[model samples]
Target: MSEAATLTRTAQKTEHFDVLIVGAGIAGVGGAYHMAKERPGSSFVVLDVQETFGGTWATHKYPGIRSDSDLYTFGYSFKPWVGAPIATAEEILRYMGEVIDDNDLARHIRYKHKITKASWSSQDNLWTLEAVRTDTGEELRFTTNFLWMCQGYFRHSKGYTPEWPGMADFKGKIVHPQTWPQDLDYKGKKVVVIGSGATAATLVPNIADDCAHVTLLQRSPTYFIPGRNANELADTLRELKIDETWIHEIVRRKIVHDGAAFARRAQEEPEAVTAELLAGVRAFLGDDFDVEKHFTPRYRPWRQRIAFIPGGDLFMGIASGKASVVTDEIDRFTEKGIALKSGETLEADIIVTATGFDLAVLGDIDFSIDGKTLDFGKTVTYRGMMFTGVPNMVWVFGYFRASWTLRADMVAEFVLRLLKHMDEKHVKKVEVALREQDDNMPLLPWIDPENFNPGYLMRGMHLLPKSGDKPEWRHSQDYLAEKEAFPLIDLDDKAFVYK
Candidate 1:
């Protein structure tokens, strides 16, 4: 029962699974769940870069960190969250753990085994993966007949380091929300929050009550509006004795379609909705606050992730003198405080960099496809899940604008379908045709952000999938439409070639 012996036994067995899943986040775990259900007795392992499961849930331990999306859509469907409409990170993480436990996936989960590189072998039609363990100098090399690249793309390991002028000089316990220090106390101390994204918004009100002075720095104005995003509707349906899965389906559809409808409106009449959104922020600020300077954003509505007052705590915090909002660019950092472009210096004891997250590509893991070094940037994403010509690989790059679970669920089903198809046809490898792909479309910012750096809110706009001629090729921000498009097992037969 020794550690090395256990590993040696595992290594000697070469425990061949039908699929090898990477990144034990929502997507990968969810996919594994579906695959387990559909194809019983099929061996698989869900691996993670971190020491624990729940990728962002486990790592992002920032104070006042909570989900932006309502828990109904955000929470897993199999498990019910009876806690509250809005959930804290701990609650969500607990929910995820429950999912793994309920499904008995804990044994299949291996953590801290970072997959550095994955290369597909054409001859064997399998993937050879290079994985390294952080704690011990242990190295693992493995191969699977099929590779499910539920490969996630968030820079979790490192914080987004903005090249702020003289930032290194004034550094007074500078912290990023992704890697918050629990020991640091902000009670009665001057705290400056620098950013306008959801993370900053969520933290401002939560921290304002404890801090002496809190200033929200905005280099560029963010689209701020007040709205309701609750799981109460889901709860009510459950009370009515409606089928829970049916309720999940309906709610998921509602959110997805609502996103699509809003996107359509933005495409049709950009200025009207944009002005209306700006007006909401203006209304929240009152007549005294400068709405034009602090609320107006450079891009139109839907171009950037809009900040919403889910609990109205942000505006309440500002009104209660607990928070202050500043719209100015950071000129540089002085020893005592930060200097803004308006020749103003704000004193601060602690600075929180809430700038935003960079769209990191799959742990920034290196890839070699058939001995060719894979340039992920040059490679166009196929259905936002599979990349063109990446044989035997199916990744889960879900929705950014809509619920994260929506596409993840569908991608799970898609993987199941493809796997079933392979088994039915007695095929080991299958390659989806690039010709079947619709490349003549705009790259959505909602998923791709290698280029979007300055504005964190707008980074995802380029990441959204292109509107294809057909639903299969299209990435619908709309939920119900996606349901019709991506059924459990209705992929285009001609699009895939069996080996």
Candidate 2:
């Protein structure tokens, strides 16, 4: 074919839609559903790098992969979660699938389309995206009026694994929890899980029942709360023959309130809350175990995420001698096991790094506005959704302290409201532009560093957008504050610029 024919064929591959959502995970699915319902005929497509729906759910395949928060808050608002409060990865995936099926969102999803770059053109009022097909290695292009980034905050390609000394010399199998090897058997093999985050908490109990022994080795200590996996109130309401909707609403309120109260207590009276939490750990493990040394955290409560082990499973495993905790730094990795800084050694057949995830803003998608590349750290966040001077784009950033879906649903609702207002006003472009006075306000981290000090968040703080002292410029982690502010937020506020 001639050069002109080749160019024509290439142009044919580029598709255009009213909106392009850069994920098909829970947030993406919820965003798509809300868009379809609120906008009616507005065309949109949800693209995911993975071949299936359920972003985190589909990606994480490690043993004991489950919800850190209760399903009442974690699950979408439109859907009612009738399962255990702490749901398994498969259950969460099934829930996501149900939501997609209910909304007919599968028809609008293009799987395995990994977005590489998205460039916004102010002149054309459009975003042009370049993506590569994971399976075929085919390049593709797309254009949209709006770009919704629900790709999540963490890097999906790999989990965070620290480089330990003599890693290459270790003859035993080493693995990261993010990418679990399916065929590897550890039925009678001793395993050492590194890190004391939520992933470690989940893995210890789940793997303990099968492994010869499971040891959780952490540099320091992390706060953990043991709670029931099922909601007793919901069960009571069900037995009373109450409507499912009512049950869902009641349970959701209770969970949210409980979560809020815990956060409040953690921030206001951290020492007291810390003591109470540690006391619970002592009760589970008995007076003989050194709860204060192994369970007590150096940081204040709510400063980092507190791992919740439903029904005290981790403690049970430890109590039953199936699992153990080692609070010490790794000196090095020997062929037999890991040498500790305290002159101790742990014998293990396998090492599982539950170290956590690598944070990525907008899935680290390359973004440019017109001809200029965007610097997120320099730009301020607009209500935790859009960035300053960024037009027709929304980023789904959830609450670090609460369930992720809670903030996701709120953002979706806010996005829909913005779209509706734009439609009513006949505006093609909408951007969050700070006023002169707003610019004078102190620019802080996306979340107050004091309120949230998660390792992943702290590590990637420079890559994320900033926040200001002003309400419009700040991203509030308080669910109640956002719950009231989002629906009642004035579109006519001086913060937003429309054309």
Candidate 3:
């Protein structure tokens, strides 16, 4: 072959690593940090489809975008969050960037590498990944001993928007918050926002003053905790001259403890919890406003996530008459706006669909084991991290009720321990399988609908892996229980097979 041909072939050779982390988002970055810190000198690469880090924060550019959870818990344990409890997207990006730069993790990451396929070869005992450079359209190949899937659970290309009749006939521009257009002007425009979730809550308050008239339209209301963004404990600690790191740990523990208690109260004494939540809304909306009709949810609190609105901003917007709420199903879209089932028409110059996300199963990548396509739905989840019949792979599916990074940090620690155990035993492969005692364990859906049934999960539940009756086989979303249980798990359990 010609020297030029030889050079080209060499350039396209498959790169190999001890581990390949699939994403540069919060979970992915956390995993990478743990590997670098605990397993120093390990060969690992972090690949992301986006041009930079901060997965959700990087891609979402909608105005007033901020975290629904408090930063003390949402932030990593190793890092101290000195900002407000609720932080904006820019603040989050800056925090993540500091983690990368401070840890010198930038060298281990490759941007714009979108994995298209992941094939596990039991004979070779490695995962072969095929990816395409989204920016350049160049095919790339890599082989890794372990695959850490942390690409997140939503389709970033588009947000979920239910189709309504006469959408094509509408004269006004319809936009989804996931892909907000930068050039689109909304100044003095009469706007209508659909959906009552966190996105709507955040967007309505931010855009209320800019729009001529804004209306928040929802089919059913969702629960929210409207309060000041400050954390009193952390503020007190700061005033006492306590270190930021110490403050972070102290405040995180307090929040987690309080959150667990609140969750229990919601489940055990839902009526009281419901009354307390509505009262908070009444405080902002006053007795004259219809809080029961506008803010009361049909389901109990914590069935779906209860978003936290900093300083009750959304309620303030409504009370000021800058924004209004309409509780009714959409009959269809009208030329000028939306037609409601209550025989009312909301006129608008622009419409924003604040609907939920389209859940992505295993990053939506085509996965196969030994030349056979893998159906995640058929396999059982092992503690919601590892799956039966999948070798040398661990996915970071974080907690829904708590800060996502809490579980991400826990999973990272578990991964480090597992890797060390494998090394000490001189094993090349490891996978979780059901023990004999688990043979008759009933298989159930990923999550029980009664416990938590969000729209995205309900829509994509079929695509997720099944869980068993035992705690070893299910994802117990209870953070407090898992925090105590994870560290005590025996590495030599019969469920783990090594070779």
User: Which digits, one per residue and each the tens of the lDDT, describe model 2 over residues 263-307?
Assistant: 999889988999899988988999999988899888999899887
Q: Write the per-residue lDDT of candidate 1 for residues 1-499, one digit (tens) a residue.
A: 9999998886774446668888788777887788678877788887787888777878788777777766666666665556565678888888888888888888888888888888888887878887878778577777887777665666787667588888888857788988888898999988898888888888899888889989999887766667654656677887899976788667765655666787778768989988887666655667787777776777667666665577577876887788988998889988888999999999999999987776665556788889998765544455566655667887676665666877787777878888887888888888665453444644443333331234533554444323334444444456656667667434446656678
Clashes of each: 18, 0, 0
Candidate 1 wrong stretches, greater than 4 Å = 1-15, 81-83, 228-232, 235-246, 275-284, 436-478, 488-492
List, residue by residue over 377-481, the lDDT tens digit for candidate 3. Answer: 999999999999999999999888899999999999999999999999999999999999998999999999999999999999999999998998998889989
Rank ordering of all candidates by TM-score, starting from the highest? 3, 2, 1
Q: How well does candidate 2 match the true structure in TM-score terms?
A: 0.98
Instruction: For model 1, state the Cα shift of residue 485 in Å.
Output: 1.9
- Output the number of the lDDT-best candidate: 3
Q: Least lDDT summed over 10 consecutive residues: which range in candidate 3?
A: 6-15
Q: Note the Cα lDDT for every prediction shown.
A: 0.73, 0.90, 0.94
* Residue 263 of model 2, lDDT score: 91
